[model samples]
Target: METSRKPVLYSYFRSSCSWRVRIALALKGVAYDQAPVNLVKDGGQQLSSEFQSVNPMQQVPALKIDGITLSQSLAIIEYLEETRPDPRILPQDPKKRAQVRMISDHIASGIQPLQNLAVLQQMGEKKMEWAQRCISRGFKALEQTLQETAGRYCVGDEVSMADLCLVPQVYNAERYKVDLAPYPTIRRINKALLELEEFKTSHPSRQPDTPPELKA
Candidate 1:
């Protein structure tokens, strides 16, 4: 069924939201073509009118599948899961599904939204130290929660949506020079996820959109 259709992902290299969708797609063993939207250069290609037609919000990580264009990383991920369920990114049990959703939301809602590149750029341009401080504060709370919930992965031994959320957030924290030593659970889980082929392959460095200077 999937072989007949082409799935094109419109994504940015450094956008953590795009990273999430990339990791989810890789885990599900889904094949897709990537259309890179360089976020840093030329004032962000995402803001262009051409990209805006695909996603009115002008956000990275929009998915075009079977002639349908969709925005929002989580929404796109859910759509992929519903349409292709072979390698389930979500748990089948109701309780486990809720747990995964809760973990994804904690980072998606509580952390990533505030610390996004655009938000941080605004803080820097405005010389707002308080915004940066708030990110650190949020990380501390997340670290504590991760410690309580982690066991091989964020929610359990199974690699669910939580692990997907954790890896990118950890990467962002490291980029910000945030002290990750305080979050041992996050550190451990992230390390484990990195060792896996799916997580490693979908990393920003591996993305075609990633700049040559940043690739390692």
Candidate 2:
């Protein structure tokens, strides 16, 4: 919990889920080591024996701290919140917190799970058009919701967990070649989020695993 030691994060540069955790860690001012797990190289380095020991699920964005390891970005973020409350990302009011969580879930549950790289790969093996259609549909719903709730940030002026969720999903949508112009809300929030130092630094292009050409 203390900032004295650095936490180890198993992450990939291009992974939106890992980028979410990276952004949260940076926002919390939590020092961490970027243990790059090249998702595309070496037949998916996350599945390697060495990495699997850290995460049996062989997933990127795992965390190791004080001999305790954790899986899943959202869960890891909640742990960080519980252990370190300063500069809180969630709202103090229960209703506001629920709203924040709702927006986070809108992306986490509603969109991310469907368009994850692995899932998209599986879909590609079946049909690429189907993959694009599903991702577009999810984005359409997200665009509508963000238009209704967005202010300076996703839910308001303060950077809640929702902003963290929104930024990376937008990046993923772009990667899938999804036209973002239709989602004016998403484009607006994405522009604002990109201006922040934390979000800018935690961007996938800024990570070590990101290709030189992709770096912004």
Best by lDDT: 2
lDDT (Cα, tens digit) per residue for candidate 1, span 1-216: 545677889998778888889988898888899999887778888899998888899888898887788888888888878888868778788877887888888888887888776677777664245444555777687777767666788776788877888888888877766766776777888999999999888888888867789886
Error of 2 at 7 (Å): 0.5
Give per-model TM-scores: 0.91, 0.92
C-alpha displacement of 125 in model 2, angstroms? 6.9
> How does model 2 score by TM-score?
0.92
TM-score of 1: 0.91
Please estimate how well model 2 matches the true structure, expressed as its whole-model Cα lDDT. 0.82
**Model 2 over residues 157-199: C-alpha lDDT tens digits?**
7888888888998887777677777778878888988999999
